[model samples]
Target: MFDYSKLPIRNVLCLDMKSFFASVEAVERGLDPMETLLVVVANKNRKGSVVLAASPKMKELYGIKTGSRFFEIPVNNKQIHIVESRMALYVNYASKVIQILEKFAPYEAIDVYSIDESWICTDGTEKLFGNRWEVARKIRETIYEETGLPSCIGIGPNKFLAKVILDIEAKKNGIAECKYKDVEDKLWPQKVEAIWGIGKRMQKNLNRMGIFKVGELATTPLNKLKERFGVMGEQLYWHSWGVDLSPVIQDWEFEEEQKSISTGITLMSDYGGEDTEIVILELCEEIGLRLRQSFLQCKTVYLGIEYSKDIGGGFGHSHTMNDYSCISNQIYKECISLFRKYYQGFPVRKVSVAVSNLQNFDNLQLKLFDEENQRDLSLSFALDEVKNKYGKHSIFKGVSLFKNATAKERANKIGGHNK
Candidate 1:
């Protein structure tokens, strides 16, 4: 139903590091990443800690994958090496891999999708790198040689096709290519959930509509799909036909005005009563700091609390403030109000704070007589300056001194894992 001749077809390569975290640990210990039975857990000491990554052999033999608890692994297996996650080490390797990609493509042509995955556009580099297949092989081999981490490459005409092919085929074959013409034969036969963006919930929704396969979804009426899923349905229809318009090269330096600034943490242990309030204050501090850094102020504050698994459910509510603010205490005051009103006093395992309905700092009109408001704003900026010059942990609210506050510990982490 789409015109193949009218579409943008460019050489896009999707690259993924094999068992990234576990492989990094294996390589550090002088073990073969593919052959070694290794698992990377969030915390080696915590039995309830989640498995973050597992080597190919570990996954194949023990059925242990990411999200599997530490206790699920086979006990006392001499072949299995369980290691705590070293986010800094993994990030260093990821940076090296990106540098390797930069050797083959310009920085602008490379988009770092995640720590261990990326998309490189090689539209004009075939003459320099031989061909797309040659470039993919060179990239895969060079990454392994330099970082000792195996990689897979999927080549296609755009980002979606490349990523889908990478996830489905390249991981098995090391490298795979899928062109528009190959979509029907190669992609359509796969289940809808196998598509890059479709999850189990989406799969069930499609199943109820009698669209269980990619081809089935592709053949369904666009108007009908759009009627049901709105813009997302139109996107699904186009992706099924291998017609992605997303640019392979992303401009990372571009900054769009943000709608919200937020932060959250999953506590290592459940907190209650006053401890939960302390956590809320820390989160508000983080959100407020982010807002000030971006020169934004928020009109709404939101708090979310997730109870322990045993408790099963929790609450999330937001309150619009009388005025916009980038002050931590102001945000915290609104969040605490929400918490006090909604919290059922169950043990809290996770907490989040957010500020939205943002406007530029320039839009905030100073109240001439409100000296307290003026002083608070001045003090917030002064504190930000101190923290920026020294460090995040260099200066913090007194509430952070509370035993339950994670601000100090989190400042040392990368993505909430050990650095």
Candidate 2:
């Protein structure tokens, strides 16, 4: 049992754009977002293209939701409109949404969770904006009037509660509030998977432990949870009780000294053999460029390859080098070593590369005899300068010109979709 009276309580609002991409398309077409049957797909030309977003009507009528294949959409449906994703446009709208939030709260008091979701702390705005509910209404109405977009708001005492309420209740009711005292009555009966942080695997694990509902998780002994799932289990136990200590207002800028520099992409089509190697090289180049941009170098290089979903297994492994470097070739070499060692040659659908064990670039120790290493580092910085002055594609390795390479095409895209 915990003392709810002693817990710090604050006003947190989690706002999520309704069917963001599809709604944006609907607004552009002058159609009501909620009434329009729209679907945003990554590639309208490909039958297997994944649906990125589907309007409420589209979902309800056809069961076409995000991750549904393009082919699943009813053919020749006069009411349904299929559109390709325009990430740049969506990002612009997301920025506009944040600007709206900035009017009511300081920028530091807002956290942009994704392109379509954000959390704003309304702790001290009661005098200007009224209570949290009033503020939520004003925000929702203002966003719709200004941008022709619809959103749902969830009000709670903390971030987790706000987000959970938003996902579970506000999406249907438009606006909902969940207080600490309401956790048991409002959230306890829901399945464990309904919680924000608990995924399918964790739900399966909890189910095996006979913890099927939020109340069960809350009532379970802390020691038992800690013994089973370690720190995460402790967090789960606390979260179930509607206890979240995360700050509502904090620095959100990318940290200069990051824990890791990573990049990943899902291939539009399966890639294998030398083609997969080329993809890996491009990923390394991205990681190296990011490290140089941040003035950081990493000692550990990690590579992950996911086989096709039909096959459904993948391998991720990392190798720590003897030296820290931001050179693309060095990272690529380490990544390639890992890929070759663990790769089963299944048609690879996704590839990811990461570099960790980071330190400041200024801390790099130069080897007296390793002049080639110094040259490679200098060349990397030189290339970075060129890319900065011109563009990302202005200077790329010769391998990028290969038929299987995606760097050139990717350079023109935003978030791997059309700009």
Candidate 3:
């Protein structure tokens, strides 16, 4: 008889690059890996841009991690090196890695954590790949050989445990394998914060209740955890015990069931006052490009603005459109209209453009009076062809020139290996 009380998940592979960005830079510059130099890089100005990546060598020197501010490091009398970040290079490398992973497993089943890390289902590949451990080793080797990027992999019964084992506990033991029997020995010794789902806010909350370790979290009452964190709390409760019910999905096309399309950018510096409107328009244009690219017509435009250094709160507004559209000009105008209402007093650090309630533009039957409809459809198809044949940037909408960094990066990445 199948046990209804038990959580069931199986055959997960967690793959993460070793100090991804810094490693990529080291490869690019031919830097000595043994050198005691801390490499930190960001978007535009070193101080202004969020530290995008740090090498393992750099991590030891300055104790810095990705997304840390540049100025936070007190000048340690030791010599340190800083490099301006190149997001484009990182994205290109990331795309190649994804392409390679897809050949081994279905794309939807793979969960992307960032530019350098992902998790995929290994259940179906055992026959073809021999064993799970061998599969993990092969994937790691392939990534290292192709990108000059070293990867650490962890295989376990579930995705959550697989990833936690890879990033946290396994690093100390070289690599970790969590079988059904070894779950208690392998996972419970780690601190509560060491688990993937727990963050600073959640950690602080758990710590207050004397739950300082993963073992303690595993033993906590599920009902109490649910009360404390609601549905997400329940997730944490199960995850601590090496339970993740999610399947190794081959595609995220199912995500379309919920309406969403978005574009976001972290600016080099705060654009507070007058320039805010211009930036919003630029962001809207880029969002429209993405919307058209996906062939999605949206009826709602939402704007989100985050103030620099303020994690507590920010401004946001949503507007319901009179009609649905993937047309850039129409979306731009609607975004501008929404911006006029939502853009308030704040020195914006990050901006996001989102459109929801999406549908097919052809089926929407928008009014013919709008020239934007015809223009956008024609342009989108052409751009799609360019991207398909030459790559994602073979052609881009003019609006992207003013706003999108990916477009700029695509233009810059002249020659690189792709398969």
How well does candidate 1 match the true structure, expressed as C-alpha RMSD?
2.7
Q: Model 3 — TM-score against the truth?
A: 0.76
Clash number by candidate, in order: 0, 0, 5
If scored against the real structure, what TM-score would every candidate get?
0.90, 0.86, 0.76
Q: Which of the predicted structures, 1 or 2, would earn the higher lDDT when compared with the native?
A: 2
Model 3 misplaced regions, further than 4 Å:
1-9, 32-38, 72-81, 95-110, 124-129, 249-255, 264-274, 304-315, 335-352, 363-367, 370-419
Model 3 C-alpha lDDT per residue in residues 203-289, reported as the tens digit of each score: 999999899988888888999999988998899877777777776675545553547888766665677645565666656656666
Q: Per-residue lDDT for 238 in model 1?
A: 94
In model 3, what lDDT does residue 142 have? 79
What lDDT score belongs to each candidate, Candidate 1 first? Answer: 0.90, 0.91, 0.70
Instruction: Compute the lDDT of residue 106 as modeled in candidate 1.
Output: 94
Q: Deviation in angstroms for 51 in model 1?
A: 1.4
Evaluate candidate 2 by giving its C-alpha RMSD to the native, one decimal: 3.2
Q: What's the CA error at residue 287 for candidate 3, in Å? A: 3.0
Residue 283 in candidate 2 has what lDDT?
A: 92
Clashes in predicted model 3: 5
